[model samples]
Target chain A: MAQIRLSSISKSIDGLHTLNNVTIEAAAGESVVILGPSGCGKSTLLNILAGLIPPDEGQVIIDGQDWTNRTGRVSYMQQKDLLLPSRTILDNVSIPLVLKGTNTKKSRTLAQQHMEEFGLLGFENYYPRQLSGGMKQRAALLRTYLFASDILLLDEPFASLDAITARKMQIWLKDFAHKHSCTIIFVTHDIEEALLLANRIYVLSARPARVLKEIALDDSANSTMVKEEILSILDSETGDTYN
Target chain B: MKKFINTAKKSSALFTLGLLLLLWEKGVSWYEIPAYILPAPTQILDGLLKHHQLLIYHTSTTLLEAVAGLSLAVILALIIGFLLHNLRVLYTAVYPLLVFSQTIPLIVLAVLLPLWFGWGVLPKIIIIVLVCFFPIVISFLNGLDLVDPDQINLFRSMGATKWATFKMVKLPTALPAFFSGLRISATYSIMAAVISEWVGAQRGLGYYMTLQQKSFAIDQVLGAVVVICVLSFIMVKIVDLLNFLLMPWNRNQLVR
Candidate 1:
């Protein structure tokens, strides 16, 4: 696990400021969630952290080293799962390993060892299109894990799955995070998911996103009051009660 | 049920072509139309059988020219298309010229080929490459351009090099489009060969047809035209088979 500190990441996309001096930190082995309204630049922030896009002004420090604008140092799981449709599940899961210069035979052997952990053991020979949505996301997560980075940035990874499956994945993810050393930065609009998975949660303001509130849920404080407080703050910001 | 319907559809197509041929034979005989104008189906068939050996030899020569030119065009298109795709500046500067080149008729290019290379296989091969490579280039470029942005992002995040990204992701995605280009270019390949052969080759369907026409052997001329049509159709079929083999995921879409 590595400590990640994002310093004053400001970004403008297509003439609109998306992240306004946004700063956050996740300690080693800690789970941090960026909870925001839809279209509030959560993905933009994750992209900056992933080094896919450099912020107009920012610094990202991972494991006490400045790693701005450098990629492949952190694993990234995008919202869509993004499994290569042409590749079999084993082949898809082996991509990060392959990218790291491992031979296909070795990579598939390594990927196959984790198929049961991913609950995708028998589906290894199937192409991505044959798998259910939940299976694809788990396979994608397995790939991200295999990327071997100490920090993982997940952008709404389970957002497309059905509610039940998403919740089940969250529980599985939390257990996995507890066992793994990587620091996970999860971005989600689901309040319940944030409450369940995060050690610390940052509620971001709509558009030109800045941190509105930071809630620490480290102590077994799964109270209804905390949910109401987060809800009220979000409801005031978006003028909607649904969040 | 699906298999039955497919078989029925194939049979109906054959039946329609057969009926049309029968009508042509009956009409020619009943109207007493001169053989010089449009030969009956039986006459064309007789002509084909009569010159089957000679026709096969010329057909083989023409086929060789088309296959050579088309294979060369594909190799060239792949190399140039990839270079242009990666070098956007070069693509921007040269893409219009490519379009402009397409407007120059194949017939004109065929004429110029003889002047440039003289009466040889080289001129015909060059002309075929020129005509067939356009669609190949365009389709390949389109496929390269259509590489998914998300796929690119994923590759970039993984710190994959540009070449690795192309080899692993872009190439697979571009295959269907490349095959599409191949299909269009396949049709052009044979036509270009025949047209080039028409200008000066000594042994091909084009040369055979010209010699027959000069002697008013309408049946033989029609027979050469039939061979050309069949050859082009076969090219299209071969491309389809290649497409099927190369892209297994796309097979589901071919069901309709």
Candidate 2:
């Protein structure tokens, strides 16, 4: 497990700041949610943490190691499932192992064992086109899980799925994290999803986003009053010092 | 009834071809058309039968030249396309020139090739390669360009090397486009060979057609054409089979 901490991270794209002096941390084995309006640079923050892109300023320290403008440290799954269309479910799930120079037969065997775990048994030979949207996402998650053991950055992984599937995925993910014991910095705009999954939620502002409010919810705190408070915080001006 | 319908649908094209031949034979008879001008289908068939040995030898030569040039072009195009994709500076400087080269007709180039390379198989094969490689290079470049950025990022996060990403992602993604380009090139390959052979060649179906045309033996010329058509269809089927073998994931959609 890894602890991810972003310290005063600032990013600018084409001279316009997307993130400004924002800091967020996911403690070891913690499930952190980043909540914000659409296009409010929530994904950008996750990208920075995942080392896909660098912040113009500030450091991404994973487990007390400063890593900026680096990659390959975390399992990063974007909003889309991003499964390869050509490969069968088995091949797709085994991509990380296959690309890492493992034996193909061995990779398929390992992936086969986890296919049952991911509820994707009997789909080893089926192509990506043959599966439902939710099945593809599960396979994608299994692939990501197989890539690394410590940290994962998921950017609205279930956003494209139907509401029913999304809820089912949320429950599955919650249980998966509990069993796996990994740090996950998940990005989403859904309030209930954030409340259900996160130990700490960072509510971000619009363009040139900074954390507007950081709410810490206890495990037993599943109250309507808590939901109302977060909604009110989102409706009002972000509590960032102006400019 | 269903079986009958299926059989009818399958035979529809052959039926049309047979009907057209019958009509041509009737038209020639009615018009009192001389064999030298427009022979009956039976006369054309007789030409094929009489010259089968000579036709086979010549057809073999044409096949050798076309297949050789097509294989060389595919290899050259892949190497050149890969280099161009990697070297942005070179691609920018020279890609437009490549596209411009295609606009100059191969027929026009066919004349100059025999002069430059002599009246041999070399000129014909070279002309075939030049005529066919352009579409391949363009399609490959387009395929390589359309690699998904998301997939790239995903691979990068897996700590996949540049070569690894290329092998697993970029290469697979470019396949459909490469096959697409291959289909176009396959259609052009035989035509390009025949067009080159039109300039100068001792043997080949193209040379036979030219010989028969000069002598105004329209039936023999038509026979050579039938052979050319058969060769082209075979090439297309071969390419389709290769596509199927290489990409089984696309099999369901590939046939229909």
Candidate 3:
């Protein structure tokens, strides 16, 4: 288990500002959601945390260590399932284990053991195309989980899924995260999703996204009141004061 | 119902071919065209039957060269594509030259091959490789490029090394494109072998055709043409089978 902090992270791509002094932190075993408008550099923030891209400024500190711009320390899942069409679902999920130098047979066996838990038991030999969209997303999540168990960075993973399926997946994920007790930093444009899943929600402002507000929710908190509050904050332009 | 449509579709093609052959056969007899000028379908069939042993021998020789050259070309393309993908400098340096190689007339090169390598199977194989490798390499490189950037990020985040990413993602993603190129190249392989044989060879359908043409054996020449088309068609079917076997996901029968 690992706790990660992106402190004052800022990035500019080809003279275009993507993220601006965005600071966020997730405690170990906590589910933190970054909610923002579309194209608000939510994915960019996750990418920086994943160590795929270095932030122009600030540091990525994981567990009191400066782990800036270093990859393979965390599991990451992008929006698209991105399953290798050539491989079966079993082989696809086995890839992370194989890449980590586990033997092919052992990797497949390990992946097979988790297939049932992920709701992909019988479809082991089936290709990605044969699976439903929700199933594919589950497989992708499983692949990410298999890569690392401590921390997971998911960027709009269920965004493309249809509403009913997406809702089911969100509920399933909430339970899964609880069961696994892994730290999760899930980025999404859906406010409802953030509120539903997060221990703490970081609402981000549009392009050159900065953290507008951080709200920690408890069971006693009024859902309707918080939803309205976050909605008002999101709709309001940056630099505007809101209670 | 689908099977019926497939059968009808196949019969439609056969019907068209049969009608064309009938017209050609009737027109030759009605117009009193000389056999030496354009052999009728019946005459070509007769020629094929009479020279079956000789034609089969020559076809086997041609087929051998084509298969050998095509196998070598595929291996070379894979090696070159891998290198070109990794070494940016080599890609810029050699990629255009590969395109340039295509621009030079195969006929001209066919003539020159024998001069350099002498009248042997090696020259013919070389000619076929030159003809077949370009498409394979280009399609493979295109497939590699087609991989999603996020997919690469996913792999990197999973602790996959550069080589592992290539082997697991890029290479498999490239297979469909590579097989498509192979399909095109397989058809060309036979023609390329025949073309090289036309320049110089002791055996092969092309060499046999040249000999028959010198003696005004036009029926025999037509027979060789039929054999060439059949061989090329067979090569394409073989490639399709390989594609089907290797890429089951590409099949239309999705369970969902």
Candidate 4:
């Protein structure tokens, strides 16, 4: 069974539909990217899938259970790094375990094991404010991963990063997810980002957004060819065929 | 070398204090001013030494009242701040009443509380709580409410409940602001307690000063004033130390 299923998920805000009867499914360990323009409700859809917000109408099924009204099945990392300024990087990463009632000592130990994987081992004692923008995002990602949920929702996690840093993060994330066999629903405005990471892409419309197209990329394609195809698809959707 | 520089700083501060005393002594000698008008610093020190036991007793009583009141204010402020922060309707409803409470003068509160309660430590402590509560609540609420909305949403998406969100995010973020208000309230607590004692009390620093003044012991009165200033300064320093220990992140971010 698909680990996460959004069945005819419809959401309206202020009487305007954002997701118009959208349905998508991701099998366990698959990486699906929701690609769209600025106001396309891609983040909103990710939020619904994570159970952050309830859809106005429809069901969100995870592991054969309706999680629309249920909670805690999915872990999400937002666009901005929401590291607590008062907490050390180690404490921030251990927060999910702490919330689950794990002892502080054990939680810190568990968090310490993943610090080197995220390139944050030495900086564990540093507070959030001591970190650079890129490092803060890394800490936030580590925190989300530490939650150890079955499904992960990443809402433009690298959107705030500089172009160079963002590219590095994209590569790191792809490797990290693959290594863990993690199920992910990632959202992004960058077509290149979607092409680089996603097995399947769901492109969305401008506002009051609905899915415009869903494309499956050849898993064996070179990075250059994949990037070119995604750019072409985006150009066609935006009616800007200047490329 | 750094230790020497720190010692130099302390010595310079002491030298300035000595210079001020010299100037005061010259003025007293030149004008042949009556001791009742303005006693010399040395005379104040002498008077303080002579009545040290009595001063200690009264100072302790006043300190106890202030400490108790300040503790109560902090607890009430945090509870109210947390409640209002979680519930917007309650915040809007109660915020104006809190503001109104602050507008009432401390002197009026001193007189009114004694009438309401009695001529005891309870009334004085109540006065200190009244004076200190508003600043703490206002600052705490501002801190709690000012958390980044995106941050709140981020935690929400992670399936963090309201209490968890507060414990993990809101409370830690609000610590700096809470401590800032607490510093202000701590100083206010001492002053409020002393003033309430002035209005009605038989034993306290304020009452001791009054008794000394009545007996024409101006030097002792000056001694009491000095003690109060020193006490207030110590309380502020303690709060600063707490801020250092609790929110170490702020230490490095100083603009200077």
Best model number under lDDT = 3
What DockQ would you assign to candidate 4? Answer: 0.56
TM-score of chain A for each candidate?
Answer: 0.95, 0.94, 0.95, 0.92
lDDT for each candidate structure: 0.88, 0.87, 0.91, 0.85
Collision pairs in model 1 = none
Q: Which ten residues in a row have the lowest lDDT in candidate 4 chain B?
A: B247-256
Runs in model 3 lying further than 4 Å from the true structure:
A238-243, B1-6, B253-256
True-structure lDDT of candidate 3: 0.91
Report the C-alpha lDDT of model 1 over B77-112, residue by residue, as the tens digit: 999999999999999999999999877777877888
Model 1 has a DockQ score of 0.74
Docking class of 2: medium
TM-score of each: 0.96, 0.96, 0.96, 0.89
User: Which residue pairs come into collision in candidate 3?
Assistant: none
**How much is the lDDT of residue A37 in candidate 2?**
82
In Å, residue A239's CA in model 3 sits off its true spot by 9.8
State the local distance difference test value for candidate 2: 0.87
Candidate number with the higher lDDT (1 or 2): 1
Please state the CAPRI-style docking class of candidate 1. Answer: medium
What's the distance in Å from true for residue B246, model 3? Answer: 1.7
Segments in model 4 whose C-alpha atoms lie over 4 Å from true places? A220-229, A236-243, B1-23, B87-89, B248-256
